[model samples]
Target: MAPSSNTRPILLIVDGDPEVLRALAFMAETRGYGVIGCATAAGALADLDGSVSCLVLDQNLPDVPGVRLLKQIRDAGIRTPALLMATSPSAALQIQAAAAAAPIVEKPLLDESLFQQIENLLAGA
Candidate 1:
């Protein structure tokens, strides 16, 4: 079931670009999700926990790549579903993310794709 207003899903969004982070957070908020925006892998890691319903991670994070960050999170035992964001991901990155079961949401996010993906992930989760 979709979460009620009082139980809105919390999203952990980690992106290097401040503008993109703000824009993504604004978009998710408009869609009824709470957003915790972070500019680096460390910040994201610090905030990650069971309370975060989902993760929107930029593939090119400055401190650590998004996929590696996901690995660390998994190693820490947080099973939150993650959506990997990339402008143009290489094949190797694609394979790695697939192995980790993270779907890549390409940049220039258009047509509410990010929200759609979030809904799908939430539904499956």
Candidate 2:
């Protein structure tokens, strides 16, 4: 099932790791989504031009924390649905992400859960 070109979901992925970013981009593209991959917060922010349907952010970005970036986006009035990916095994980070109303997908994301989550978000939107 190819994504509809007229209304295909756009996903913005912000992560510094090339490997992870590539994997996520592959997953999204294979699933018929339009993916905008950014390696920095600045890059992601630059691409947030209201067309994006969802954000997939990395918690351990080299420039700033993923949550902080998310906050900045929210402050700027971008209410796109977001999923945070955490590289560390920190329960506190997970709690913080939950408190911010964003779902957390652990690094080295295994199984089909992440894909399912993305599908659900797109379907809901």
Candidate 3:
């Protein structure tokens, strides 16, 4: 289905779980965001661009950690805001995410917080 919003901010979500990826993409699309879901960090890196309004990356990826991927994205000069999805993140991971300015969204996204975070990020973008 087409996005509901005219602007339709693009969101790139990289997750290792197919189910999680599909669910997140559908949720974002329903909220009027254009969603590009990928199963690997490499695909996410390749798809990274200025057009993307935000990113939702899973912490446990096949090729690399979500935080590491964010670093690569920044190193490549893309300042797009990102949300790192993790379950009970470690102190080091949390520190790294803070360093990269990517907030950690807990997994099993059970409430509207994820959408709120996305909107907040987009608003500041």
Candidate 4:
């Protein structure tokens, strides 16, 4: 059965890697969040619907920088909470993401930190 709209956290995940996308989707679904996986910035932008409660983005997409995408969405007045992930993110990138009000989750998502952080962000939102 489909989860009730108000009960599930709708997550929009944007990553270039198909493997990562699949893993995230499975994780999100297993955790009972409605998952929307997109392989590109354009695809993600197109799918940003009202139901989405969070934006999970890869820092370096082939088509556009994850920060850039977040900025664009914010500029468009979309206030969806965003979690940006990168592998060893540069200092400048970290500052930029914070300036944009998006939290940066360093890549290799080894522990439960990612999920914990997501929970905090969404709960606060």
What are the per-residue Cα lDDT tens digits for candidate 1 across 1-125?
34689989999999999999999999888778899999999999888877899999998999999999988887888788888998899999999888787889888887767887888898894
59-115: candidate 3 lDDT, tens digit per residue: 999999999999999898888988899999999999999998888888779998788
Least accurate 10 contiguous residues by lDDT in model 1: 1-10
Candidate 2, residues 40-109, lDDT tens digits: the string is 9999999987889889999988899999899898888877888888766488777877766688877678
- Model 2 C-alpha RMSD to native: 1.9
Query: Candidate 3 lDDT (Cα, whole model)?
Result: 0.88
Q: Which pairs of residues clash in candidate 2, taking residues 3 or more apart in a chain or in different chains? A: none
Ten-residue region with minimum lDDT total, candidate 4? 1-10
Model 2 gets an lDDT of 0.84
- Displacement of the residue 72 alpha carbon in candidate 1, Å: 0.9
Model 3 Cα shift for residue 31 (angstroms): 0.7
* Model 4 bad stretches (over 4 Å): 1-6
Give all TM-scores, in the order shown: 0.93, 0.88, 0.93, 0.93
Which residue ranges in model 2 land beyond 4 Å of their true spot? none
lDDT of 3 at 120: 75
Q: Candidate 4 on 1-125: residue-level lDDT in tens? A: 33465689889999999999999899878887888999999999999989898899998798999999998999999988888999999999999899888888888988876777678778775
Q: Model 2, residue 103: what's the lDDT? A: 82
